[model samples]
Target: MASDPVTLNEFLTERLGAGGVVDDPNDLLRYITDWAGDHRGKPLLVARPRTTEEVAEIVAHCHCHGIPMVAQGGHTGLVGGAQPDAERPELVISLERLSRIREIDPLNFTISVDAGCVLQSVKDAAMEHDCDFPLSLGAQGSCQIGGNVSTNAGGLNVLRHGMMRQLVLGLEVVLPDGRVWNAMHALHKDNRGYDIKQLFIGAEGTLGIVTGAVLKLTPRAQATRTALVAVPDVAAALALYGQARRSCCDLLSAFELIPRACLELAFEAAPDLPDPFDTVYPVYVLLEVAASGSVDLDAMIEHLFEHGTTAGMVLDGVLAGSDAQAERLWQIRERMVEGQQLRGEHLRTDIALPISSLGDFFHTASRAMAARSPETMVIAYGHIGDGNLHFNLLPPADLDLAAKKTLLHDLEAALFSLVDDYHGSISAEHGIGRVKQTSFLNGLDATERELFEGIKALFDPDELMAAGRILPRTR
Candidate 1:
């Protein structure tokens, strides 16, 4: 049987030390919520473990007593994957204290770090050795490597470097039984049987607790080009992307789509942010290309501009002249989320579809939004190159909280129905934490659910890890 709150608290304090155990409501407040402020939980206690051995001990104790637990790092996840269950007496195992750079193999082009190491710190460490870790995100400064790996994060650089799954070569995870599995090998080729490490990469901490990782790195970009090109519509943007890929090839780092509405909100949110052009076009494509060695990136970007203009895909554009100028152009993309926040209650859906289906989806979704809520504004944008769209809805701002939520819920159903029609994922880069659990499961086939459940049973038979997270707790 699971121990009582008092027993669990004493045991945690004994194992993790009094300083490591946070039962005080004030401190627990920080661990209870997520970065998006969308989900909150009531964890019995937050346990801060300083080492892998300490994590194992805590897990073993939990396993023995049938106590549920959730592994956390930075708590910057959009989905409620890391937050403890409000109903369960779950322990929040925060890995922040395990922050460390175990090794950096410059020649091998890899960096192994503790799960608690912040994403920006890992990037900085790689840069110190003249290497680059390309998993770039808006929350990189606060998000941890473990959480990024767990969610299989795809950020601005995903078009160039791929997601966290591609960058992570190996991992060190603490299983539910409290046994440590050290597969943290920085190997480029491991043709051995089934890749065991792949299981935990995007598992959302449902299967086990990730403690360390060996991540792949690339050479720092030596030459770069950035431009914000105004396109007539999604088709024009698509043509521009194709031209960019053919012209710049592997150097194409980011290709983001920003609608005029999103930009307007961005302007409202950050007035100091300069406009890229005088004429406000219908849509904008923020294109960035980088190379490690000698290559005429300037000519490549110039050719893209020339071709886009000739093809009538480019309406108006601005090519960044300097690093500062490039950063300024990128700021428009970065401030988009803040713009959504400024707009009040909004439904954010991270869905991915085939590149060709984007235009159809856009038009169809617009019609759907109009039919459902005529006053609701659709402010959509995302990494167009990867077919991921952050389809968002800003309903009538004057509605009260309850009314707003009801409208959002209805709008979400309408949009997701479109997502279903287009045969796209409801959750792309972001894992289906607590937010999309119902829809995610409803969409899954019986066989798929069975397989998932069997796998969960194999790794976490007790279902004590991350209760009611990706899947509901059987108990």
Candidate 2:
């Protein structure tokens, strides 16, 4: 077992101040549940540490007492990795108070910030310096850098800039044993023996608690263009995406594939938003291009539209004539999550396969889901430039919530099975926090599973850091 809850709470209050510990049931409820509202578990106490030293001290004390700790950042995680179980007598080390942007080196093109700093704040800081942070997501306003680093988050701009791992230059982490590993160097080339920072990038807080990070920045775009194109099907979408990639090359910032059902949901949920194209097609692609040097972005986009029209791949295309119009067009893509909520419960999957299998994967998975649960609505959308797709399944709008859940589970299983058949990863950009832990295990072989467990054991011998997350439990 573990230490007594009363004793642990007392110790936390004594070591840190009374303000650092929260034991009230009502206040602890928010920390217990995940963003998806799917996983729920009450924690014994919540610890809000404001400094790196405070985090280290708390983790050191917990390590000495053999108490499990779950590091929470933003709590916007889809996985239950942040969920703390009161029965298990775990402590939640919330990094909310550690929010701070330490420094911004315009000459070096880097920014050092505390892990609790929100993603949007970093982006704003980069903008002030006439640079860009590149890492972005739907939850940028709420999600913290620590969680992004832990998950190695990838977003729409990943096709051009890359994922969180590529942007991160250095990190400060508190290991499971409570030892502080400070490698906050912003150097481009270190030639170190073993890149220690890579170990915790996507480890999901199982190995350590990320306290801060040094992030790389890029030049801000001088001109940009966005478009909403109506394609006949996924085949046409892929072809258009290829042509745009060849024409725009590195300038092609994002290429998103949105199914007709998703667009309809957006229109239904958010009535204020207007659809750009007059005629609706079966599939639509939201594409964007940004460049630093002055280029005829309008003419380039016009050429793309004309080529797509002549090839019969694009039925109709609408280019953003103004910056406000560009933002409005982008809003349609950004509101995908909000629109998804208008439907019934959603069992979402983020998977990545080979680019060639993108069309086949969607067709096979959607067909399998429809056959498994005929009433479920399949809303498909995501970054098509890369192979990642957000395959979301919603229960029937007419059915009761309970009945819908029963059907949703069956549909999820069918979808995961098809993804496995295609050799696709179950959890792509989203880390296997708690929601997808079981599915990750189901998709992996015995040897691969063993390797993951071995790696976990090597980093966290006692497994006190975010237990039952990323790794499946052996009962």
Candidate 3:
């Protein structure tokens, strides 16, 4: 029941005027596809709304016409959640023009911003006000604040700070039926009612469109230290992490576990990068400690490494002497991704387990990967402090695209089957977008599925908002 071609033209002309609607095919192409160039779709039209009223108007019009709509922000998501449907007549509503930082309260320790404000810009704004925004990610330069909230993103600082969920104090959302919900309380204590803002935080636009948010800010980190460590195995890495926590006390900020194979790939990708240690160990850890007080953080970090070496937990290590050296060490970690992209046709899994189960799960998952196929090489690296691992499988040199495609099912099943035994989630930071929807649904129990369905129906009865991305739609 989408509006007819003539009706659509008339609606745009009357409601949005000239600059609001984009009709050029080339411009349309940018909104249709994802940033990764993997998934592409065709949108009936792309609407750029400059204000909240404009968004509500578009949503209400689409609802009246019985047309589906997909809300997009930044479009840097790895999962195909932002991509609209090509077969159906769906409207793609881009919030890019709504970029604005409305308020930054220093005393309240909050910053309220429009959905389209880029993540790095928010951080810069907070820093300018002599505060800090702790939610940091590699895509912080381009990813929007709305997308970060939608995914409830977890990054390197989650050990000290929390995920995007914990940072958001309140949200201003436009519901599926075009009714607005303004919950921008920006208060630390609001216990009178249910936490309604929680629903829209990680819903990924299935229920409503997040137009604005109030995020908590923190005092800027004063003293900082980083180190590249070598551990015997996952068990040693866990032990070292515990020691690091006790040594650094409240200052331990990041503890990442990196496999030896992943390091080799980084070296291969970046020849200028020098190895931190003379002896190559099976595992390495990139650990950091930051303090807001006047603590000698570098000395404390060095002491932690020395004690680790004495306890036989660390084989070798190097503490970053200067800020430039620390940045270089991080560059190696960032370049590991490019190293991965150079190797084609990889199966990447973003997963989490209980902190206690990490060691056992890591060993078991490695054995499982080996049993499934010797051709697939395992490269594991992630924020071990929070029990999340990016366990990636590299395809064999001889396997072609068609053959790799055939093994995709077994590969995914073999990995996810471990989740059942370890009481872990199939996805940790990444939401169940179009790419993971089928597997996600299959892994859920009857009660969980029913609950999720009820929530979806209650908010979006017609399921017109980003239909088939997180949940399937009925004809």
Candidate 4:
């Protein structure tokens, strides 16, 4: 192999085709920035590898050259985890070309796929086999399976199906030094010591580049009932959730909390978005109950509405009569994110608290925000079933850019403080990328920090893979 710097592109093109090594700056634009446009970097080139062997070769070459590398999936990361570092020139290895459904075992209830396979494609394939991949998210159309596994993403179905961590049965990873670690098994019960695949599941591509995965699948739901219910407050929402848990048990798939501000914003962003209720409410719960077999899902949903209304927890609600209606109802929750984006810049935080302490945290956090900046809009909404809240803060319209910046900083300080007081996680689903590194490090204890550093050293001894992503950059 030639080690000359001038032949770097030649070497890459030799391992992969000429189309694989993207050295042109025009084509590099897409790989340099994240979906959020929050972070951007300048990389020497982008390597699109089709096979795990090609990925290993690229990583190994970069490792030998002392050049850091960033492994990117669909580039849908919120925390800039997929973005390369701007200060240092890094090699970005994109897995988009490796999109392929390797195998689907109906008997094993597993789907083996290349990390670059689009999430929605995997879901569609599962449905074809009379199964379901329950990890549904807003970016399902574009986000890749590898990125989902790397972040251990939590979506609407987390309450029933668990996060990506639970769904992933095995992984195939390219280690820092270009060695491949293949643990792509579909077994459910493995009592082997130290589940090696677990290390790379949520490591944010820091430990290694995820090449493929074997994900667990669930039986397809025959009947799904969707409803948008108005609640008096967060407490009422929690009460409704308790009733839902009692009535449906594991059959309840989704229970999202939607505050009035968030809904109003969504309406403003998308005027075509229909309003389900006649009157406005302080809070809302978008709940879905789904199950397979001959179970009467409608009866279960009706019973929940009855109990909720009887207990004065439900103010007003609308239930979908058809699959199309259910999809339309779901659009309200999905479009809420777009609404926030239309409202301009806002500080987004993914925090989780104990399910029981959610109401108290909301009230306490609201009061604290009021004290800090009464004009700041607190558009908090999230997967209430799993206790994760996207506590977003939108600055006042009157504030200038500088003022908005300060307000966001202050708002983050106040909100994260409240999260700490409640002993909640700083990041609920989004991994600690470059954006939250300081906060993540601040919240870490000395012992945990030492352990994290040790693990990073154990895998990425030279820190050439995804430097400054999850763990701080040593060099």
Which regions of candidate 1 are displaced past 4 Å?
none
1-475: candidate 3 lDDT, tens digit per residue: 5476566756876787878887788988888888667789888788888888888888888887787898999888878888788687578888888899999998999999999899999999998887899998778898888899898888898988989889999898889899889888789778977898888888889988989999999988887788899899999999998898888877898999988898888888898998888888899999998877798886787788789989999998888889999998887788887788788777777899997889999889889988888778888889889999888888786878988766755777888888767988878897988888888898889999899889999998988898887777866
Per-residue C-alpha lDDT of model 1 across residues 1-475, encoded as one tens digit per residue: 5467788888878887888899889889899987778888988788999999999999999999988899999898888889888888689999999999999999999999999999999999999998999999889999999899889999998888999989999899999999999999999999999998998988999989999999999998888889999999988998888888888867999999999998888788889999988887999999899898999988888888888999999988899999999998888888878989877678888999988899889889989899988999998899989999999998897889899899999989888888988899898899888999988998899999999999999999889898688887778
The true-versus-predicted C-alpha distance at residue 414 of model 2, in Å, is: 1.9
Query: Best candidate per lDDT, number?
Result: 1
Worst 10 residues of 3 by lDDT: 1-10
- lDDT for predicted candidate 1 compared with the true structure: 0.90
* lDDT, model 2, position 82: 76
lDDT of 4 by residue, 310-349 (tens): 9999988899989898988888888889888876778988
Taking all chains together, each candidate's TM-score versus the true structure is: 0.98, 0.96, 0.96, 0.98
lDDT per residue, candidate 2, 1-475, as tens digits?
A: 3377888877778877888898888888888887777778777689999999989998988888788889999988776777885457578999998999999998899999999999999999999999989887889999999999998889989989889989999999998888999999999788879998998998889999999999999888888898999999998999998899888756999999998888777778778899887776899999999988888888888889889899988898888889999988878887767888655477887888887899988888888888877777788889988889989888777888888877777777777888888988887798887678677777778898888889888878787888888885442
- Sort the candidates on lDDT, descending order: 1, 4, 2, 3
Q: RMSD, each candidate, Å?
A: 1.2, 1.8, 1.7, 1.4
User: Between 1 and 3, whose TM-score is larger?
Assistant: 1
The lDDT of model 3 is: 0.86
Worst 10 residues of 4 by lDDT: 1-10
